[model samples]
Target chain A: QQPVQSPQAVILREGEDAVINCSSSKALYSVHWYRQKHGEAPVFLMILLKGGEQKGHEKISASFNEKKQQSSLYLTASQLSYSGTYFCGTEYNNNDMRFGAGTRLTVKP
Target chain B: EAGVVQSPRYKIIEKKQPVAFWCNPISGHNTLYWYLQNLGQGPELLIRYENEEAVDDSQLPKDRFSAERLKGVDSTLKIQPAELGDSAVYLCASSPGGRWGNEQFFGPGTRLTVL
Candidate 1:
């Protein structure tokens, strides 16, 4: 089943922070995060396994709550380049990774 | 190394017509995936392949959709007698196989518009 993302869209000023959440109905084995800009492919951000581990890449970070079957993407001091759609892909099994509807994040100056 | 490559970046077709999208994954990546993304929504997996073998395709609409990754390399996804509901971005992604959560590198998707 597709995961559900909260706050369908969010607008932020440069240097601000924002959070996007993804929740799955089924138990999650892994959570993968990606960012997609308009007219471009989605770029890999990071992956969190089922251990409730937290990962960070640059100012972008993510946390996976294995028990809750949910994950959250945290963007700190957001930049203009961060304006894009953030997608959370959850894998309940080994190979099938299902994505949420996505949270549109726009960072302005 | 080159990222995943997909082509005919955009396609416009009428209902009942046929269309196909091609993808070349990153070198040595053994797992490839095809996903359909609607406007304002995240991509939904249509199929997954390991090498030349399709390991999962439960979400693919078998009636009019088909995909193949021959020789364990480049792949193609085709839709026959397409319908307007099929309009969306078709994305191809690949990851090095064998890990539980390998990061997938995606190709610039093919935006199909079925009229």
Candidate 2:
């Protein structure tokens, strides 16, 4: 099943922070985060395995809770280049990976 | 270290016409996937192939949509008698294997417009 993302859209100023959440109804084995710019394909960001772990990328970080089947992405000190649509994909049981609707984030100076 | 590559970035065709998109995955990647993304929606898997074998294609519309990865390196997705609803972005992704957790590289995607 497809994951559900919260806060359909968000606008932030440079150096601000934002959080996007994704939840699934099924037992999640892993969660993947990606960002897509308009007219471009989605870019892989980071992946969190089923161990309720957290990973960081530069200033971006994410936490996954296997028990709740939820994951949250955190963008710290957001930069203008961070403007794009963010999606969280969840993998359940087997190799099935489903993406969320997406959250559009606009970062301005 | 090139990423996945897709051709004919944009295409336009009338209903009932046929359209095909090609994709080349990253070298050494053994798993490939095709997904359809509609406007304002997330991508949905159309098919998945492990090397030259199609291990999962249940979501593919076998009636009008067909896909093949002949050499296990390059793939082609075809839509016959295309319908208006088929207008969307087709994305190709590749990963090392199913054991790899959510680490897939994507192609630029081919946008198709059906009139």
Candidate 3:
């Protein structure tokens, strides 16, 4: 099954902070995040593995709670370039990956 | 290294017509996936291939949808007698094998418009 993301849409100004959450109904071995801009392909952002392993860029950070089957992406001091749709992908034991509906974020100056 | 490559960035077809989209994965990548995305939504997996062998296709509508990855390099997805509901973007992604849960590289995707 696909994961669930909260806050269908978010509008923020430059230097603001926001959090996007993703929850899965089943056990997840890993959580992947990607961002897609208008008229473009989805770009890989980060991946959080079970046992508290996180791999991503310094500009962005995320956390995964295995017991809760949830993950959160944190964007601090948002910039206009951050405007796009964020998708959270959940991977099960079988290596099947499913993505959430997505969270649309618009950052303005 | 070059990223995933897809052809026919935009295609417009009438209902009941046939359409095909192609994709070439990055060098030496053995895992390929096809996804469908509608407006204002995230991508939905249609099929997954592990070195030319389709490992997962539960989400694919086999009756009209078919795909092939030859020699585990390039892939082609076809829709016979397309329906208006099939109008959407078709994305192809790939990842290096030998490890599970690796990050995937996606192509620009082909925008299909069925009229």
Query: Could you say which candidate leads in lDDT?
Result: 3
Worst 10 residues of 3 chain B by lDDT: B96-105
Off by over 4 Å in 3: none
A1-109 per-residue lDDT for model 1 (tens digits): 9899988999999999998999998998899999899888999888888765544476677888887888888889988999999998888887679988888998989
Q: What lDDT is reached at residue A63 by model 3? A: 93
Candidate 3's docking class is medium
TM-score for the B chain of model 2: 0.96
For each candidate, the DockQ is 0.88, 0.79, 0.78
**lDDT of candidate 2 at residue B2, scale 0 to 100:** 94
The 10-residue segment with the lowest total lDDT in model 1 chain A: A51-60
lDDT of 3 by residue, B4-113 (tens): 99999999999999999999999888889999999999999999999989999999999999999989889999999899999999999998865443688899999999
The lowest-lDDT stretch of 10 consecutive residues in candidate 1 chain B is B95-104
Give the interface RMSD of each candidate: 0.8, 1.2, 1.1
First chain TM-score for all predictions: 0.93, 0.93, 0.97
Instruction: Decide which is better by TM-score, 1 or 2.
Output: 2
Question: Just chain B of model 3: what TM-score?
Answer: 0.96
lDDT by residue (tens digit), candidate 3, A1-109: 9899988999999999999999999989999999999999999999899988777778999999999999999999999999999999999964578999999999989
The number of the candidate with the highest DockQ is: 1
User: What residue runs in model 2 are displaced by over 4 Å at the alpha carbon?
Assistant: A52-56, B98-101
TM-scores for the candidates: 0.95, 0.96, 0.98
lDDT, model 1, position A10? 97
